[model samples]
Target: MCHHTQPVTGVPLNSCTSREKTSILQLLTLGMNSHTLPTCRVHHMEGRADPGRVPAAGGRPEEGDEADAEGDGPWPEAGDPRGEVGDFLSLDLGGTNFRVMLVKVGEGDAGQWSVKTKHQMYSIPEDAMTGTAEMLFDYISECISDFLDKHQMKHKKLPLGFTFSFPVRHEDIDKGILLNWTKGFKASGAEGNNIVGLLRDAIKRRGDFEMDVVAMVNDTVATMISCYYEDRQCEVGMIVGTGCNACYMEEMQNVELVEGDEGRMCVNTEWGAFGDSGELDEFLLEYDRMVDESSVNPGQQLYEKLIGGKYMGELVRLVLLKLVDENLLFHGEASEQLRTRGAFETRFVSQVESDSGDRKQIHNILSTLGLRPSVTDCDIVRRACESVSTRAAHMCSAGLAGVINRMRESRSEDVMRITVGVDGSVYKLHPSFKERFHTSVRRLTPNCEITFIESEEGSGRGAALVSAVACKKACMLGQ
Candidate 1:
């Protein structure tokens, strides 16, 4: 619904004219090499900044302090800490879709289980995302009810694992205090609400189901758990889908949370806030600045905007709009539909760049937008995709590099063999995203051994695992 247009040439708006000229010169010199794009180098902008140092908190506790006060020992590891067989449910709540699944875990060779029911992906309405907490939870509860009924999972008091994919402050595994909304979700009353309580209330009201909401995990943490459950070598979990973020295991000794438990399981480090150091030499273009300035958590997640799927298409649009104003491409006529959200999805752009089918894909994209296109438009579209994606990939790599550097500084280990479990459409489906990220990581750490693994273990199943762990822990405490 956005109808904003780029200013025509010769119209000066604030410092945009100077910024645009600077960006153009930089782009001309860099050509197709996006690694050379100028980034904002301002140091210590405004926000809840990351200290860049490992926090004192170790692995999160099993329950709230009340559980600890009950003299309950640490939560039991999923299954036999050493063994690998258990049953869990995972619910992945993403920016655009909600996925739910039930999984059974077993040990090596015999350590296999069925998805029981196929995973369900329900598209979330935009209003639901930005509406009241009640409306949003009501919609989610309805979807969960339908899913349970369809799968015939109606009788059991199932322990549920909830993967709330947003930044949160957690006192333990069973709770997540919302920090702020991101990924375009501006729902009121949800920012500071307890996500677990909201979902539990919704589920209970919607289905009259007495389900125990056990663990509340982040998507990256769920990815780590899923990967570690499968392969012990998997140390890092990264999400490059709608938004970019990562989680990795940390030693208990390095975390301040565990004042006494220094010999415990690893803690999840929210690595998204790592690369905020103010030592940049590049320039942030006007559009990049605008996107950063207007984001829900502006000045934070700067790198995320550069790489995440949600912003890639917008970046391309801004660049294309600029090009149009300059008469470099798409000149003369402007496509009215191009200004809306998702007018040009990154996937479509990538297809336009890589498709070999007589430019059919480009034609289809243009047709969908009510924009007639000629053969010349194909080249323009392809170039735009390439330019935008390349920038995104480079930015992603830089973020990864920052993590690697931080890990090296903390652990000082020799090129630790780390496997990054990745989930999301951008990282999994996009043709150029993975390669570009890999290239950037290699540039930063030539000798560091790293592997990118796809996680079929989604949030829904992850949630189940968390539920199982929490239940097991609670039982030990006789709660």
Candidate 2:
């Protein structure tokens, strides 16, 4: 447990007292274990309760258990193809949309798989995210049914891979216990229910599909797996769109909680919940607090609120509102456009900041907001972008640093090539996001080699691979 508080001082735009800055930096150095800090208190929101405090190391198998290494059961030996070539269906449930794809794995190179048909992306309604599981799954089932009908897919019992993009506790490749909802989902039945079983039942009700659900995977984990299949050096998968999270391979021994197994492959760290310690740089400002306090999971993922696209625009709004209230900038505007949540998307700000043609970009941005830009407003917009982007980069680096530290501690290696597969609109499209992330990594790990691989293969393909592996493992065990 670590606790540190600093006085807010200086102009809202620049400079923190040296002493206060030092204290905050010290607080961050305590690492993720600083959860017990007295300042860390869970905030209350209607319809949102604590997700039953997760253990410090997450609830997965601990490091000490031999089972932590090679999984709870036996490791499948080499030379076995693991049913690499098979027809499998995959589903990718994302924050804003859901996709389902049918893929056929070809026997040849390890990770070279081809999609049999075009994938489908359906824009999910906002209500579905917060409604009952039946409602959500029914909608998904209809999509799947429509896909199958359009493609004339065989009615046989083909295996299915379910890639659920949320925080879930898994006992194996096939089972996932829902931890809590992220990506704007607050469905009642989905919170604690078995997602695979729910989807399976939903599909079964249609009577036209007889798919066997085999594996469940988080989006980041799937990205990692997919990347690893293509490039063995890939070790990390990160998502930075509506929300931010990273998954990286961890040695089984350092986990401390697993009971058995020794040669485990990797443990997905799910590092989004990191940096919730409130030890962030003073730029976190009161708007950040309101965002955190009002979120479904308050007092958690403070750093995410600073960086993730889901909150960046809102942060800008808060800061802009403050500026207006203080008559500092953007004064005498309608302010009505900023009243709604997510009124300003992160991309809008990024566009303004990336604009290099004199003040034309700034003028365009303000014009879109129905506000004529003054020189001060232009400066304010540029400053806001820089502050938000810098804070995001710094916090993102902290997460990478934690993972690198964990890896070094577990392996005791001098220098290792770490490949991080990143996905999401913000990461892919946001200018300077990559540069800032690289800067952060370099600052944190001077000796390590890091590679960033952008992957188009999302949870859909990754889940299919997991399903194939699971089925192959099951068949081998039966033999």
Output the TM-score of candidate 2. 0.80
RMSD of each: 7.4, 8.8
* TM-score list, all predictions: 0.81, 0.80
**Model 2 lDDT, full chain set:** 0.63
- For candidate 1, the C-alpha RMSD (Å) to the true structure equals 7.4
The window of 10 residues in a row where model 2 has the poorest summed lDDT is 42-51
**Every candidate's lDDT:** 0.61, 0.63
Q: Which residues of candidate 1, in runs, are more than 4 Å off?
A: 1-33, 37-87, 106-117, 261-282, 293-300
**Residue 182 shift from truth in candidate 2, angstroms:** 2.0
By TM-score, the best candidate is 1
Worst 10 residues of 1 by lDDT: 41-50
Tens digits of lDDT, candidate 2, 177-296? 787776567878887778888888887787777788877777877776666666767767778877777765555444444533355544555556554553454435577788887787
